[model samples]
Target chain A: MSWYEQYRSRYARLKQAGKPFFPYAVFKDMVVVSLILAALCWLAYFAGAGLEDLADPTDSTYNPRPEWYFLFLFQALKFFPGRLEPVAAVVVPGVSVLLLLLVPLLDRGPLRHPLDRPFWTGLGLASLAAFGHLTWSGYHSPLINPTVEKDPLISRGIRLYREMRCAYCHKINKKGGNIGPELDRSAGSGSEEWLAKHLRDPQSVTPNSAMPKLNLLDDEIQALVAYMKSLGEPFTAEAPKLFTQNCASCHRIGETGGEAGHDLSLIGSARDKAFIKRYIGDPSKTNPDSSMPGFKGQLTEVQIEDLSRYLAGLGR
Target chain B: MIAWVHERTGLDRVWKALFERHVPEARGPAAWLYTLGSASLFVFLVQALTGALLAMSYAPTPDHAYDSVRYITGQVALGGFIRGLHHWGASFMVVLAVLHMLRVYFMGAYKYPREITWMTGVCLLLLVMGFSFTGDLLPWDQKAYWATAVGTNIAGQTPVIGGVVSRVLKGGSEMGAATLTRFYAFHVLVLPALLAMVVLVHLFLVVWHGISELPERRLQDGDPQGP
Candidate 1:
């Protein structure tokens, strides 16, 4: 007999042979299913989800990675290239779904055996394999941008600066408020002791300054100073653009931008390039009470060297 | 005690009719195919419970969505666990639905009288995709933001009607506060209700058509054609 005829006769013989949907079969299924669900709950208790840093629109340093299931599409975008992006983004996936929805309508044969209909069954298997391959490849793809670890002292300084809410008045790299002078570009303007005393009692260093007394401990002031002393003035040439992208927000040369930190018009005269370089790399090394954030790993050493050169050349 | 309640409500008859109903004997290897539907329903139930818990604390807005998620993950007791359950449940449901539809298709269950069941199954698959697209955007992270931009851009490629469709799906020309609200509405309200309705119809059809028996398996006890 033909496959379809054999299938029909077999169905006729088996149609009434199976068990009921309830206690006999469903209950048995439920026992195993319940265990599977409970296992899921157990997994939740053990493998907790990940939480990253708070979303910041301004920080271009971050590399965005989607959830695992969507990674294939993320990887697929790389293949599209430029204006043809819509092909990968839409056309391909779109047509595949349309074909999938049309499967039942297109294939109306009575043959139950998959071998009787090789085309659709083959297509399904092929599509599944393709999706699996794409997902696996996506998971293995390298990160586009990698973030370097922060220094311990700088990390501590950052914590203290945020905790103290110093950013409210004093600007750092264009962030925070415009009430004080910019720190990154205006690094060499303040001496170590002067910077310390200023943090302890702002009125002492700069009379009529609107800054408040944070009432921080000696070590806290030192860490804050360490942070500030790290801010380097931007170098000349291409370094100025880097400064604008990374530093101009808080630091200023004259009247060009924010005044949250001291003016850097004459930063070259106040400190040499080596001193500026050290301060820019890790401000805490120079002024223990500084509030500036160090950019050791954030900026490459070469960029820092160029920026320090530009800073040393300033005011001359 | 059980008999007493049944006496008052006549529920025992209904229970007997439902539980004792002679389903086409889905014996041996063929019975395994029935597993996916029930499993899909179970996953949906779990998703509903977890999703409700998530909604209790979730704030649907541009400014607070990310922070609220952080709060849920970090501060709320078992919040991360609930979120994980919902996340995995969605993926599980999609898998189960696909497997169920495949079984039906391979069995020729969608032929002739069961065409509606097969079509509804396709719609359910579409709903799963919709849920995936909408749920990803709720986190409001960089991944959420940019992926959604790409996803909506895909929607905007819908041939002649791409512009209006994408605009409506995003709730505007650009993704912002309205996009989040609209997606939240569709995710929490619209999809669940629609899914529930479709599920009821699918179940009703299944009950009416009876469980499909495998053509390869022979009768265990006696001939179904016997008088």
Candidate 2:
């Protein structure tokens, strides 16, 4: 059969076999579609959506993650830093979709076989695979959620701390200001009664102390005290000089410090004396990626011994 | 009684005009591929239905949007299920539409007279993506908040009209109540309306041109030099 005759006959057969565009096909589709929808409702009944904590803009520790479907886009953004970010977020995805839309106009191939449309088919498959891989990795990415679940009283105190902007002058963990001390490390030494007095007026509790009177309610003061007392550590009067001079800049032993280094508030609880001595003397000996400057040449042997002993005493 | 009513209205024409249309024969596995477009349409309708129900209880202000969603999920009967349907339906719609496009493209159905159909399809895909981006920030949870911030920040980084586009998306320098309201309006009103219009046009084009006969079984209909 010639191509023209084949085409005419195909149309003729199609016209003869064609049914009314109504109940016959619509009914079949409705049945399948309704069944699928029912299955979706059933699945939804079993697996409810997850809801997390409310948004707290003040909480510096909050970890943000995108929805599962958007993980690929989110991961892609990580690759393009600074000014080049728009390239990853917009240009690449935009260009890819534009190219996809252009496929129809560009590929005027008569052949429908998958093997014949190698470029378009291969591009689609490759993009799909990359999307699948990126989404999978995005799902498996390390959690950015808050690490600790604070007790109720401590949590209330944290809210108050944020509202009061105490962090403007005082840090908790390694987060606040350097004006006063980091409340996390500094408060560990204060007794509940002492924090209460300090909350009323810092001048009354410690002379020459520049801390302001927060004038907190009694219950709020109690909550703050509870929060402070919870940050417990055995007072290490011996190595205070060394810690203040070196580690305090980065690592927060209790509350007062910068966040560029590890929070050492619980390091004493986790590390042994020997490990501390070696790690602090030369952090690279253990963690190749450790950003801590080695104190090997800077500190005397006696000073290293004192610092390690002080840290080791901070047991969990 | 039903037969009497149907006979008077001549409602069988509805069925005849819709479901009983002549479908061109595709060889082998290719026949199953034709169903994808219908499947995508089905999922989209489902999304529309569920999204309507969701919007009834969804507050469009930041102060209440997140809480309203929580209440819908926790307090209202069947709310959680309806929300899941809407959520999953959006995902399914995107997947199915892409598959439909893929099927059409690989089958060489986009050639010649079908260019308009192909172009409308690309528009539909863009609309679907627009729906996804706008709908995502409605929940106002931590994930929603920060993801939106990052997403909009990317828009803000664009040169020239970057700030303007970002402000339009967010309704201000910061994302707040106005942003949520704008997104709600777009999701429920604008995008869906645009999609419905596009979808109707697409269907009309499909019916007018008829489903592209298998490219392998090419007709020697004019334009001899045509691929």
Candidate 3:
């Protein structure tokens, strides 16, 4: 007989002997379970919503927090001290894991039934109860307040921003550092809708960005947008158009800008448009080895004129 | 020569008598539950060996913390796999330990002399947590940095020692250079040593107190009946 025919006959013999078959009832059950799990996973994804702005490493006001699922760990860290911080963050979790490992060794009673294993059952129930309690407590923990006092709403928004650690990547005032764009001036210049859109899906605005979608609630997004909009009063004068064309590479005027150069907080006071234009036209005139490469060829005369005018109007 | 021979002969007689007296005439049917303790011990041994290997390549500094881990994974031979093994082993150990405890508790093994064993086992569980907490921060990446920050802040919320605890953990008001070193020390020196001693005591106790027997049934005549 051919090998395949011989193997098939052997398989049939094994099957006839009453061994378990592939694609059995258990397999069907697994398929049903997997479909249910996939549906639930999709639902969770929809619930989380969209991403936030690229994380600004420099912003002191940005608060960094984990997702809701990790809030229990986040909340527990609040109770730990210096060296002991790990005790809560790592040790407690580790011990819980260890206890779980020892359960089989420790609870060696002959009883397979729950009634026969009262102590084990009690331990399991108590653990479940404690986990639920801790998670609830974490979800309800008091929000951190900013050092400076302001309108309650504004202050609360600022606190949320910092607690979320948005500042870590984004710069705001001259005080904050900068891995992301400067936001101190962004509030004055960027529209509320733009800010909201960026918060909702930063990648939609700037592709190849590192900011994860925050999936923030509508109210949370509104509060954050309002807070960003309140950062500075509106600028009225026509800013040098060249400021938009060239200055953004290194300098951020407010919400949207770059990291390579200094932030133009009071650019109108620091240097006039004429000087800014000249600087942009040929940065070599100012410093021989200035890393701020000249953008002379990058912009036309009219565009440069508008950017200079725009920058000169920023401080006021 | 005669005196030495007599001393040696007497010692041999004592050893023979002790072994003959202690040996059980019949061995009981061994159950699957008996394997849990041995399994947990096996997991612990795996953790210890893998953990020690990981410590050799780890650099405990903020500047080099991330880079060192990268290096360990990339440059050190089989370092990445070993690290993964250690991580999984720790999780496995915890799981096995809990299973062991459950088996004992359900068996009513905690009664009588086994109560001490159960209590010691609980302490060991706490130490295992200590090991995990300290080890998690060694990587010093963004995950470790903020996680540690949130953790320390929680400590600062405690009534009396809150500020003191937070300051110590962060090395000041926030996580920085000192935090990594502190966590590394605890992970490598403090926790592992303490855990080793605890495990020794736990094992000693287990050996000293024989495994608890299965519960017996009472006969109509008020005599104990065997299973």
Q: How good is the docking of model 1, by CAPRI class?
A: acceptable
TM-scores for all candidates? 0.72, 0.71, 0.47
Better of 1 and 2 by lDDT: 2
Q: Answer with 1 or 3, whichever has the higher TM-score.
A: 1
Per-residue C-alpha lDDT of model 3 across residues B80-108, encoded as one tens digit per residue: 66666666556556666766776665555
Candidate 2 lDDT = 0.75
- Categorize the docking of model 3: incorrect
Docking tier of model 2: it is: acceptable
Locate the minimum summed-lDDT window of 10 residues in model 1 chain A. A52-61
Higher-TM-score candidate of 2 and 3: 2
**Cα error of candidate 2 at position A129, Å:** 2.7
Q: Write the per-residue lDDT of candidate 3 for residues A158-265, one digit (tens) a residue.
A: 757876888787776554557666776555567777778878898998687677889988888888876775565333334444455556667887777888887785
Worst 10 residues of 2 chain A by lDDT: A19-28
RMSD of each: 9.6, 7.6, 20.4
User: Higher lDDT: candidate 1 or 3?
Assistant: 1
Better model by TM-score: candidate 1 vs candidate 2:
1
Tens digit of per-residue lDDT, candidate 2, span A184-255: 566867778888998988898789998877778999998888777766543446687788887888878766
